[model samples]
Target: MAFGKWVKQCFESVVDPDKENEVAELTQLLQAGIKERKRSFVLAEVLQDRVYKQRHLDQARNGIYQRYLARAWADGRVQESELEILSWVSKCLDIPPQTLRAINLETARPKFAEALAKAMDDGIISDLEAAELTEIARAGGLSLPNFVEKFFHIEGEQFLRGIFAAAIADDHSAVDVLEQLVATAAKLGLSRKVVVEAIRPQAVQYIEHVLADAKEDDILTSQEESTIRQLIETFELPIAVQVYIDEELRELRLLTDIKNGKLPSIAAPPGVNLKAGELMHYHGDAVWQFLRLLKSGPDITEHPGVLAITDSRLIFRSLTRSGAFGFGTIVAHDSSRGVIEVQRQAKPVQRFICHDQSRIPAAIFLSALRMANQTLTSQDDKRRSRHIPRDIRQRVWQRYSGRCAECNAGEYLEFDHIVPVAKGGSNSDVNVQLLCRNCNLKKSDKI
Candidate 1:
């Protein structure tokens, strides 16, 4: 037979006739009775002792007696209706109505009436149901308030339904709904912990909905999806954490190129100036080192050159190698001070070298050197009294469009020594100039 049929048969066979009759009556009352009416009837039945007495019945009665007694004592009078109800219950139950009245003379007041009213409103419970519950409570030696609290605690279907409603209304994002549910439970004076525990499955369902929506919407790219899935599998992180990891990874990749050799290198453009006789420098030691290290290993052959410059600070591109770039600066001077400084001053401020030597034509370097010399000559003119070379000055004048090369404010300009006479430049036209006073001062011998 089916499970329900089997259960019904077992119950019918095991339960005594009196108990079965009581159950049948309760079922009928529960099926038809309104909340408050049923609760009143249940309370009447409890007082009448329709249910069997247990060792804990006296303890349970003590609480009910105290509550009613306190109210009677406070009013300095007992309502005749309440007294009649108490009397009827006492006579039927074989308890002393006089004893209850005596207690009321000292203390009595309802403590959980409001809670009982609410429980009645929720369909999971009713007055007749509470009467049945009271039987169990009395048998367990629990007061009415304590019994009601425990009953609500163990039955959380209503709480779960509320959580489900909130979750559905909020696009099925469980965290948001759960937070509201927690606050609501607290405000309603429900057991927050028990409610939360009961609603956990519903919350999980909502979380699944959120994740499903995200996936269906393609909010995460293929790579992001893969990464998130991996994180979820490996770490078993919550959905929120998985989303966070995906976002973080995406941001990092946006700021960097991860594919090997994919990043372009900085190149010295044609005709740019370089200081002649000054040793030229190239910064690519990190790339080279990475290449060597990766080549030495068995896993890979090449790595991408990851290098960039920001605010004059050189940033090396990340590589799968073991070491960072080395910096070396070269200087050229008269034999007396011919020295080069080789030290790691952080990293290159800018990357100007190509990894593929074949791509760097010789003409590019030559042009760069010429540009560098022009820059140096311009500097020399400012620091000495000797005139700049006519050829150099002509170029300078042309560069400044025949205006004063120094201030760019005066026409009919002169060539002034960028280096002073004491610094040993010639006094000839090569070292002299026709200049406006502002240009002369502004272009004082200082490079």
Candidate 2:
């Protein structure tokens, strides 16, 4: 009946491996003692000192005590459960969930605790606040202490101030002001990681605000916003964020243009045929006019003599004796002048321009026209055409023995324009020479 005598009997019962019922009875007794005493340490020490099977008794004491605490926390009132969990947590590294809630509610630990207490006392934080904070902390991968410290350090005081100020002014969106505070911190060079760490404790609320703002502003498409968020996870700086935004914007523009029929939908190979997505290298007024006509629906019947065939730019030309369309180079004419004149090719050949076919597109063709007009206006001297014809390109390739001039690599040979198209060189024979794609791209406009 006495504590000492009862403990002695329990110790004996615990160590007797053959006495299964006695061992079970001893465990129950030990658990009852721990619950009644409400002291695990005392129970542990008593088992260690007085029990016959010291190790087994000690194990039973700790295990039963922990189970008791866990059950009580799970079943009892939240406050009582939290107190018990905290007590156990203080003695060990892993705190129970109830204890974590208690710690979150505590306004006494340090800076964060003090701030939280003030906010709660001022009615700044509602009942929902604790749950929000907990969720945020879990999402941010921050411990309770770390989450509190970072949140208070970053925006806690400012947020309280904003809330009080907003309440006084009768503004409903007090939360928006707090978000602006966080954005201001970001702009002021607060590391994204730091902001993320601080925000995780209030992740749900922060996310709601983000979604609302996105909807209100209509600043980013859903895809763009998702990409931004992903990039934010990887890169947490403003510059990196801006770079991604710019890239997304450009892609969006391209997609929109393609969708609206401003840009073609099909992919056309570069060189002769003008397809929607193809790159053209030629620059000339005639080519520009041709591209414009193609983009605008043309009445193929108007040009009865015009023929459609593969591998030729002269779709419409005067017919020959054969019923099949004859292939010939058709000269471009200036209708306004009522005269036949040599067609001026777009100058300063674009090394890598989008192609409709081998021909230039309307957009780039227009750019060349503007450049040419500007050039003519600026200079009083007679304009001399500077182009390299195909014959010259072949001759140059023959001169180089069909090998790279610099490296003598012979697998792929191409015609290289010595003067870049941007600089007003033409695709004529005199200005062009043969080089491999590698050498051509490498040489670029250097010469």
Candidate 3:
């Protein structure tokens, strides 16, 4: 019944014949624990039952993934959440991201292949093929690289044109679409200037055309002014071109508000809780928009959002729609006090703007985290069922007031397992809450 005996016995039960290195480490730790009169440590727990440890973790990963797949299926295809988690889930499980992506591609490949075949039944991806093609692309889950070795155009010029036309045809929609394309191109290692240049010929013409569409009786209305404001911040234009645009906008009386940064208020519905449920400890003014260090891009790059420090987490919710421009929560490096780390994806942690860096809630965030479990392990490993019952999803949805448990906004909601289905959490209504896609990304079930 002694701790040392249990540790030795569990060590012997490990079936790996090629784990002499691990065995040596285990024995060393056990000996040191006994010599130091330390009864147990967190590392000692993993030796208790190797099978349970591995099996539980595997089931946790699989269960949550299955839940994602099922939901993705119900939504008619794979989703961004399903795609993004492939990296984090693999990291936590200590598997290669490429391997997880390969597995995903394997399972998703055939259904999409058949869809693609149907789309090409007419010999071309015409209007009859457009919907199918979109589904196929979503399901393929391949071809996009983390970095650009060379400029890649596998998506085809027509595909790009289709995207551009679909996104830009509407005058109001063009402003948002341009931002999105810029962001996406950035992921492909294209600078904003490069992206603007690629479309330079049309950029001016489209800007003028859209502006004309916005004018009413040759006078820009309030709606047109707002549109101009949204379009005005893109700095990729040449100084001279920007000057011309500014002069034109001024003539149309749309320059002042755009230049001064007049923006729509962030106030949500009256009863919606805009803050986290508990730990309203932070008393600082929630600056409407400040820049955070960009997660994985240029050093000068920053995401605009209000910095939030609350009971549950310290998160930077981006000002961009669906949190399209945010970074990760501030997490601790380990159990070491005062040694904290920012959990970011895509890129290594970089410095933020000086003003924003001064506002990081690292001290309080780390203080709270130190008191809790050092490892934010998922609960899915030991749950009774990974499948959440529909009734439970409905119940949890109502419990959260039909808003994202993370960010109380948006109506296009998805059910997220609080403990993550892969970690063995149930599909019971108590286990799930509705979150908009943006909040879901912010609150991914992965570590």
Candidate 3 residue-wise lDDT at 278: 42
lDDT measured at residue 67 in model 3 versus the true structure, 0 to 100: 50
C-alpha displacement of 409 in model 2, angstroms?
32
For model 2, residues 107-164, the per-residue Cα lDDT tens digits are: 2233334435543554345445554444334333355446666655545544544443
Per-prediction TM-score, please? 0.25, 0.29, 0.24
Q: Report the lDDT of model 1 for residue 309.
A: 24
Q: For candidate 2, what is the TM-score?
A: 0.29
lDDT of 1 by residue, 199-276 (tens): 655443333323322322213345444533542443344676556545534433422321211223344223222333
After superposition, the stretches of candidate 2 with alpha carbons farther than 4 Å from their true spots are 1-25, 32-41, 44-51, 75-77, 80-129, 132-447
Q: Which segments of candidate 1 are over 4 A away from where they belong?
A: 1-145, 165-176, 187-189, 220-447
The residue-level lDDT of candidate 2 at 167 comes to 43
| lDDT per residue (tens digit) for residues 1-447 in model 3 | 999998976876586443555444544544354346433333335345543334434444444444545556665566667656544434433444565565666565566555544543432345435544444454545442321222234332233334555455443365666666666554434566655555544445455543433221223567755555555455365677677666556644522232222212233322224444344322222222222455674343445444443444444444452131221243312211111234345445432221222112333343344333335433212222444454565456447755667777533355666776545666666666666655665564233
What overall lDDT, based on C-alpha atoms, would model 1 receive against the true structure?
A: 0.39
Candidate 2 local lDDT, residue 368? 29
Please identify which of the two predictions, 1 or 3, would achieve the higher TM-score against the true structure: 1
Which candidate do you rate higher for TM-score, 1 or 2?
Answer: 2
